[model samples]
Target: MPERDTIMRELHDLGLAAWFGGSMMGAVGLNPAAEEQGTEVDKARVASSGWAKWTPVNAAAIAAHLVGAAGLAVANRRRIAGQKGVLASTLAKTALTGAALGATAYARTLGKKIELASSPEQEKAKKAEKHPISVESAQGQLRIVKWAIPALTGGIEVLNSLQGEQQRPSRQIWGSLRRLASA
Candidate 1:
């Protein structure tokens, strides 16, 4: 493989790692931690604070994924024209990444709502059983983003293998890429 190709692969791998890790952290660590820290009334505030703290880190991870995706696109642009599987994989990754981004934004908005409810005036609003939106929505959005990372990353990996195959002279693209990566 060319040095540029290898470098691009490494960057893509790094981005995948970040995307997966950040999603996992938000879903498993931060969300759970916030839940454990507060009562129903205060839960949103707590969760929001935790997520707010996590925002910059998550942003960095998403940025890494974007950079890696750009690298992959640049490296594989020529080969993608002839590879149906590669094209499909790319499309899948793009869709999943977009979903993850949307979910992240939704989670952030929910977090902000939680923070808003933390105020003294909002205390009265909180006491109403159905007034504050269900925590389930926030949790669900986070879950969507969390699962999306792995699904999308996995798709990218498959796509990467297909791209690698297209570069080879004669070996079957999918099988060869998998074998080479495994070895």
Candidate 2:
């Protein structure tokens, strides 16, 4: 048996958990609540504020997840290379991660656009000042980008489950055997 990458596993699981949960909550709860704000401008402001607050923690979680995933990949390089289905799943996970990252970055970018576009005249950020977008345009972009993160991260969790099952000793043995038989 191999030594467990315990820390890496925890970081990977926890970070992903936070990432998924946060996106779900924002989509299901925060965004909906923000939509209830009296005016359209208020709605966008509330939503952008909620997203802004989450941005730092989300970034940290994403970073932690990536670091943990890299450590785990290195630790499990042999299994990933030799075990049947593992490589395929890992590749799939990687693709999902990439998509999630892109979606996250895009959403944050939209958030910044919203913040800039919606900020009170007196409280504008310099960067946002330089690139002016209409509040309606920012809101429109946000609406479209909203679902991608949760969906991508949710797929990652599903793949995580599959990968978890693949780690069973019997399954490992069978997978490796299948690989060997096919070689």
Candidate 3:
């Protein structure tokens, strides 16, 4: 096939950058700031508000990343099918992305629970959906899941680098031969 030019690479890299940076900033900056600025009773509310504001942007970033990934996959179908290790790495990246998405969704759910539990507005608190677990327990889980998001996304970045390296002329030639022999 002829060489195909696309902006998928830029989209993928920039989307991942936003996702990673936003998560890290929320964990390190926004959350701490909320805790410090708000009263004891309002800390969770403050943090939850900030995260709520970020949710839409984060969703967009994740969507862009997924679209770019699909585009790249379609463009490189032959390479993925014929290159040794490429298929494995692609599969691993897919799984990691799914995990990251799940972590993000779970953390958001936990955050919402904390927000309701901490709010002074009894009506709002009452309106919040009940979780099977206590708000305190969800908070504890959120603390860990929040950090896991950035870590998993960072791992995806590393895997992306490996994929780029594998595209090198020498690596591609060797990978193709290895793939052929194994087949």
Candidates' C-alpha lDDT: 0.64, 0.86, 0.87
Backbone collision tally, model 1: 0
> 135, model 1: CA deviation in Å?
7.2
Which stretches in model 3 have alpha-carbon errors above 4 Å?
1-5
Better of 1 and 3 by lDDT: 3
Off by over 4 Å in 2: 1-4, 123-129, 132-134
Evaluate candidate 3 by giving its C-alpha RMSD to the native, one decimal.
Answer: 2.0
**Considering TM-score, which of the candidate structures 1 and 2 is the better prediction for this target?**
2
lDDT by residue (1-183, candidate 3, tens digit) is 233325777677788899999999999999888879646567788898899899999998998888889888998889999999999999999999999999989898888888887778887677565667677788789779989999999999999999999899899999999988988
Residues 1-183, candidate 1: write the lDDT tens digits.
Answer: 578666766766776677667666766776677677647656666766666777887777678767767877887775554444555667776886787677667656665655655645756446433445655665566556556655655565666566566656664456446555656
Structural similarity to truth (TM-score) of each candidate? 0.66, 0.91, 0.92
Model 1: lDDT of residue 156: 58
Clashing pairs in 2: none
Off by over 4 Å in 1: 1-7, 119-183
lDDT of 3: 0.87
Model 3: residue 37 alpha-carbon error in angstroms: 3.4
